[model samples]
Target: MVKLIALYRHPEDQESFDKHYEQVHTPLVEKMPGLKKLEVTRIQGAPMGGEAKYYLEAAMYFADRAALDAAMSSPEGKASAKDLMGFAGSLVTMMIGEVSREG
Candidate 1:
């Protein structure tokens, strides 16, 4: 499987960010054609009792890189990408990678 991981740093307004993320952004992401699963993480803290650099993490799963590419090339994907610019652009970091499993 391939996944698109998005790491979100703390935005200036936490409440607004959370509201928009849950209400608007998630729905847009769900519209992607090849999206298999979506996982979200609320970061707690870093090791050694320091602050965590990121506030939230989202993993969007696809069957493979080709599926992911197709999804991103679709109109829904474009809408999601454009929506990111509406909020929290500077605080987001995204990456795509293959999933590795260990038994």
Candidate 2:
């Protein structure tokens, strides 16, 4: 599997960011053609007892890199990308990678 991971820095307004993310951004992301699964996490303090650098993290899974690329090039993907610029651009860092799981 391949995944697109998004790390969100602390925003100026957490409430507003949460609202928009839940209400608008998530729906847009769900529209991607090859999206297999979506996972989100709210970061708390670091294990060492300091504040976390990231406020949130999201992972979007796909079958492979090709599927991921296709999804990102689709219309829904374009819309999601454009929407990110409106609110989360400066606060976000994104990456794509293969996933490994072991039981």
The number of the candidate with the highest TM-score is 2
lDDT by candidate, in order shown: 0.95, 0.96
What lDDT score goes with residue 34 in model 1? 89
Instruction: Give the alpha carbon lDDT tens digit for every residue of 1-103 in model 2.
Output: 9999999999999999999999999999999999999999999989999999999999999999999999999999999999998999999999998888823
Worst 10-residue lDDT window for candidate 2 reads 94-103
The per-residue C-alpha lDDT of model 1 at residue 92 equals 97
Using lDDT as the measure, the top candidate is 2
Cα deviation of 64, candidate 1, in Å: 0.3
Candidate 2: which stretches are off by over 4 Å?
none
TM-score of each: 0.95, 0.96
Looking at model 1, the pairs that clash are: none
lDDT of 1 by residue, 37-59 (tens): 99999999998888899999999
